[model samples]
Target: MTYLVNNPADFVDESIDGFVAANSNLVRRVPGGVVRATRTPPGQVAVVIGGGSGHYPAFAGLVGQGLAHGAAMGNVFASPSAQQIYSVAKAAASDSGVLLSFGNYAGDVLNFGIAEERLKAEGIPCRCFAVTDDICSGPADKASERRGIAGDLTVFRAAALAAAEGKSLDEVYEFASHANDRTRSFGVAFSGCTLPGASQPLFTVPKGRMGVGMGIHGEQGIEEVDMPSASDLADMLVDRLLDERPDGAASPRVGVMLNGLGSVKYEELFVLYKRVSERLEAAGLTLVQPEVGELVTSFEMAGVSLTLFWLDDALEQAWTAPATTPAYCRGGVALEGEPRDDADLAAAHEEETPDASEDSKSDAAGMLAVIETIQAKIEAEAEDLGKLDAISGDGDHGIGMDTGARAALSAARRAVEKGCGAGTVLMRAGDAWANEAGGTSGALWGLGLRSVGACIGDENSVAAPVVAEGVVEATDAIMRLGGAEIGDKTMLDSMKPFSDKLAEEVKAGTPLRQAWRRAAEASQQAADATANLAPKKGRAKNHSDKSIGHADPGAISFAMIVSAVADTLESLHEDAA
Candidate 1:
């Protein structure tokens, strides 16, 4: 239970503020996250790493000399938005390219991949890689699908060290990839973690039982079993990792990290590490500079993970490299570089608002009202949505939606105040939603809104045909960007139906308000129908059986938004009459 919290919505932001204040000597706050205070070498590749916020010491704490140049921090247990990643990369980038790395989670993959493409399009070299080292997340043959856990340290270190050595972008990427392939981690939780302001933990373990193969983000474990003694638990962890040793590993030496998830004390870890060391030595493997403490953590989770980094010659050299950061440090660091100039660290600025026709400005005001209505709907249903998502996912969907909708409303209001057009208002709102929400749904919704905005330009009055066209554009953009089909049990399940119904009604000359109401009805039906589906993508895919009776949170939220918009339109018509 997290006791110290003001507004749960502002927790991540406030925490980052305090973190930057305390670590100002080693790091400085950037727009999206934190960057190293010292300047990198002129031609060195910038190793930018990140993920959700709760996993402290992992992201911001790792930014310094011989480690990550920057970290794009996100919402708690949510991946950073593409805009956030782009901002961090731009701030940290030098003459050389940037290397983006993070855990192998769906949200992180989507957001980071988008950022990577954006950087390349802007003529900045960038490459993104996800660490897949958790042995129990997927079958051995499907190693790429495994979730990254405590083993992230090994891969991040290898890449950052190579970058600090002035290696090229390709070299840094190769090192990170190779490290990921050679690393393996396994963990178990005695109890689950509670998110800030939440009344209950995400998941619970029965008395005398332990959840095995647990994720750091409060994801339920794959299996539950009787709690074992410390010695037996160490053997269990050591044996699992040893069995999955990477092929072609000729070295007997390995780097070991016995990581505490959150609440586990250092004394307990040392006890476990003693048995772990004995087990590894007895198995004829040598441990080099083994770390036994909190590294990658889940906010107050009572769990531990064991990570083994099988080291070849190159990997060992990189592993031994010196580093100094807020939470982690190696042997003596020189601190030889000059402090980064404040001008060089300026955040990316929002674009200037464009002029709008009077009619378009009137439409913008209506859009603002619609956005406000959506925000209200999301806030009202957030708890129920989160409960639904917790059936198979991490249970943050409701909070994420509420956060995004509020941000969108704020941005829409600002755009309207500036006398912007409907298109500009929607586009600005979308950007704000993505930047603040920072997750898969955030990225997709942002893309969809931006697409609609592109179809309805600032100069034109929005009509039924134009609105239907914008819906089609939005649907197409979501499908293209998310790579999820209609039946994938995502927001598309509702969005596609809504788009199709609205287009058909408009083609038959239906009034815009009536057609939109009909479309919202169709969306609701589609969202409900998703209860019969087994998710084929995202985090729910890992627990498809558990999701069978629950509609996807994304689909439900989309339906809610459209229905709310329909009601808003009707209210406006009534007021005018």
Candidate 2:
């Protein structure tokens, strides 16, 4: 049921026959399962990328003008015979010579290694390049132990470029090797993929979870983490790529790829990219180019892989070169959507805004620092938060909070660098919090930031009354947008009471510090009360009584934040007085 194929025994050959038949103009079948381009361009060093047949658009589908010159095919998820390797190597080589690139596997090593010797004997200069980019496969002492996943694209592209440039056999070999060195890939599977015609999946990761570092053919992953949002999953994959990347490289331009295994939606791949871009930016890694689609796949697998390439000038140039094939092609860099100037947005504002001042800068920094501290506190309690969410929700609050907090800090830093006013700085930071933090948390957190921004306008320093107004405004937005009011067992239970108390204290002419302290205390009290209330929204809403004993994570988070805000205000007031 997992795989869709006519016959298990005829799977590999049938697939190869179909591919060659479909693209007779570009490829021709060679002896021993290898396929070569019908016409090899002279003076171009040829790259023949290959592997077991199941991972499509990989060793085989890549054969074209700027990609592979040929592909040595093997049985389904099995290594190709040595004859298969030799045929492709000899057939694809031209005056520019030939380079053999494949995933790093034991059988591939022996077969391709022998193929090289045979090519040399026939007076054909054939060199070998093995891709070892799957970071999930093994540790440093044993990098060779890893399997090749989506990182194969980087190697192929690099080799394609080197060959296209008319590089000699040694140069092309080195370029391919460099691509392997610069590349790193990680994969996660929601479910295992079935080999063609197989009734059962090669492996199974339990439902609602992901197997990180899973192999292309249903091998076990390093660990299984509860299924996270698209962004969270994307970040986990990107972070691993960033960490495992080779050093001493100029231009940390990444060729980010979100590869869908067989059945995932192409649009979902873009969603994956949206998260990937945020994570890459957060880590100070510049993405020179990004690719999103199914570049490689197992039959009917629900999974995605991220491949990062550290590009040099040559690699960048080659990747942009013209190329076309059956499943992939060079569509010139798609235009980034129309530009919007933030300055124009600010200018269009109907309200009068205050000029930036040293005082405003200080206030902005102080508030952000408070948020940063609150983020740290929340991060410390992530496990507990996740456990709570798991009980009646998606169990992502802990992860979401950590991401939102960091996003806020980064946004704050950018605002500070731009000499923005306190309100604008906080507004931008909040936007980052919403946009970068994935899922429902992003929506709520973003609304909170917008609410604060709406009230502050151009204020340089917060007076007791303005601070109270901002809190009240933020509370209102949370209520309207989140649709959760007091006793609804959500953040509003804490934020609403906190805002009212703050406003009352401010109107009574209480000192800002005292008003904040009262607000913080009231917020805490309300947050604790949520444990007794039935849930009313999101997945928690489904568990009406089940969520009764667990305090709403949003409420606890709100209380912790307000307490930090109160502490920050106290510090600011002391400095002013």
Candidate 3:
């Protein structure tokens, strides 16, 4: 349990503030995260890596010489918003290009993928490679689906080295992708990790038992068994990795990292690595640059993960590159010269106010009211939504939703006050929600809202048919962006139903209020029906069956918002009448 925190919600923000202060010599704070205080070589490509907070050294701590040029830090245990990623990447990009690297998770994929596109659109050469290195998450054939664990170190290192060597963006991306394909990681836990101010751990382990195949974020392990001796545990970790060695290597040269998740001390790690090293040698494998300490970590998870980077000649050279950072280092001490050039660090462009009609601005005021109503509803149901998520997920959904609703509401109100149109107000609100919430739900909601904004032009008339068409566009856009099907047991379950019903009702020429009511009813039914479904993504993917009896928190929240929007519409009607 983390006791140092003043408020759980403020943890991520405060930590980043403190981190930049402490590492002032090595890193400087940017809009979304930290960039290296040390300048990169001119015309060199920038390798920007990031993910959630809590996993320290992994993200911000590694932002310095010979490693990540910058990191897009997010909230604890959540993927960074696309807005955050875009901001960091824009700041981090040099004249050459940018290559984005992160662990393979749904939210990270969605957010980073979008950022890559946005960067490309702005003529900044961009590419992305997700590290899928966890061996236990999926079969070897489906290894691409595996969630990245500590192997992130290996992949990120290669990318940074490639970038530092002044490689082109394509070359850096290739090196990063190659490292990911050659890396594999597996972890075990004696217990689980407690989030800041949380009453309990994300998941629990039975006393006197250890969970094999545990994840860094307190994902429950696949197998639970009696605790083993240090030597036995080492053997289990080594043998599991050996069974999944890279092809075409009878005696592969490997770089090994035995990473402590959080609580395991360096002495314990050294002891475990002793046994691990002995076994690898006995199997006639050559170990190069074996790292035995904490690399990536959960808040205080009493667990460890072993990352094996099967190195070829080129990769071995890259892995051995000189690096200086707050945490890990290699080769020799390097002097920091300067931070990134402010002139070269591109900031986000100023948003232009599109011409909006007075009637559209009035509709924007209505959107603000709708946002307020949704926020209140989400605030009231926060605990219940969190409880629902806790059963099969990390249980952060309620807090995430509340955070997003507050930010969205605040942004919408500001836009309305500025006399912006409904589309601009909704777009700004969506970006705020995603940036503040910082998760899968946040990313999807941001995309959904933006889709609606795109369909409803700033200068266009706001009508029931246009609003219904916006819903249709939102449905298609979110489905494409999130890659979730109707039965995937996500917010889409409610969203698709609402969108379909709204479009149908509007087509039938029904009153806007009545059509919205019918759609809200459809959303409610779909959300309730989620109780019979199972999760196919995010934290619940591994133990999806456990979610069978509970409605998805995301779906439930979607239903609640739809109902609140209906009330907002009804209130609008009443005022007009």
Candidate 4:
């Protein structure tokens, strides 16, 4: 458990602040995450890598001279929002282009993929790739479906080295992909990690036993076995990795990283490494600069991951290149770049309010009330939501939703105070939720609100039919962005039912308030029904069997929000009457 923390809600942000303070010479704080304090050369590809916080050296610590140019840090065990990724990429971008890379996780895929598209739409050359190195996550034939683990270091390093050599975005992406393809990681844990303010660990291993194939995000392993000696454990890790070596490999040399997942100290790691080295040498493999310490860690998880990065001639060259970051360093790096100017950073700007009719402005106030209701509901139900998610995921859903809803309410209030229309208010609120929440649910909710806002223009009064249309638009936007259908056991399972019912009622000339109430009921039913279905997406999909009896946290949260909105709408109607 984490001992030092002010507010659990503010842990990620405060941690980032302290990290930037300590590494001032190596990194500078950006809006979303951190960037190298020194500027990159003109026309050099900017290598941006990131994921959730708690993995210290992985993200911010690697931002310096010859590694990641920037990292879009997110909440603990959550993907960074699209807005955050876009901001970090823009800040680190050079004349050449930006190359985005991260672990092959659902939230990261959704958020980073959106950011990549946004960059290209703005005419900035950009490409994104996900590292799939955890051999335990998927079958070898479906290697791309594997989650990234400690092997992220090799992929990030290779990309950064290519970028430092002034390669184009395409070349940088190629190098990262090659590194990912050649890398394999396998992990085990003696115990699970606890989030800040949590009373217990996310999961637990039995006494005198260890979990095999455990995930870094506090997920229980696929199997459990009696604890083995250090030498026996080393053989288990090294042999499993050796069996899954990349196909068509041309070299006997490999870059090894025996990464400690938080609580395991260097001494323990070195002991394990001794046996690991012997096993590799026995298998006729040569080790190159084996790293045996904390690299990519989960918050105080008593675990370790072994990564074998198969090195070809090209990869070996990049692997041996010089680097200087806060936590990890290679050979010697010449410091030639000047410090970046604060003013040159991409800072947030105040948005100008657009003209709107009195009716639209009044409706914007109503929208603010609904958002307030959502914020309250999410806060009240956060613990329950997290419990549901913990059954199959990292168990941060409740915290993420609470953070997002609060941000949305704050943004909606500000927009209404500025005399913005209902459309602009919802859009701003959506942006805030997406930016602050920084996960799969956050991105989808943000997109849904923005879509609804866009469908209901500021120039027109919002009627029952128009509201129904907006909801449909929102549902469509989520489906498009998330690529999930109604039965996928996501929020879409509830959202689709609510949207369709609302549209049906509106088409039948039902009152807006009455239609919304009915739709909210439908949403609740759908959410409850998800308990009978297995998850088809997100982290939960990995442990689908475990989630069979529990409703999806995303679906439950959606139901709660819509029901709260219905209550808020009824109250407003009663007051007006």
lDDT of 2 by residue, 69-103 (tens): 77877666655644566666666666666788888
lDDT tens digits, residues 1-577, model 3? 9979897888988999999888887887777898887665567898899999999888998887888888998888889999989988887787798888998888898888778877898999999888999999989988888998899988988998888777888988888988888898989999998889888887888999999998766788998989999999999999999999878644368999999999999999999999999999998889999998878999899998888889888889878888888886787657654556556455754666778987777778777887889899999999989988888888889999999999999888878877889889888888899999988999988877877877776776567877888889888877876778988899999999999999899889888888998999999999999999878867787888789999988899999889988878743323221
**What order do candidates take by TM-score, descending?**
3, 4, 1, 2
lDDT agreement with native, every candidate: 0.89, 0.71, 0.85, 0.88
**Candidate 3: global Cα-lDDT?**
0.85
lDDT of 1: 0.89
Better of 1 and 3 by TM-score: 3
Which tens-of-lDDT digit does each residue in 507-576 have in candidate 1?
9988889999999999999999999999988888879999998899999999989998887764332222
lDDT, candidate 4, at 219: 71
Q: Is candidate 1 or candidate 2 better by TM-score?
A: 1
- Between candidates 2 and 4, the one scoring higher on TM-score is 4
- By summed lDDT, which 10 consecutive residues of candidate 2 come out lowest? 340-349
Model 4 TM-score (2 dp): 0.93
Clashing pairs in 1: none
Task: Name the regions of candidate 2 deviating beyond 4 angstroms.
Answer: 1-4, 33-38, 331-577
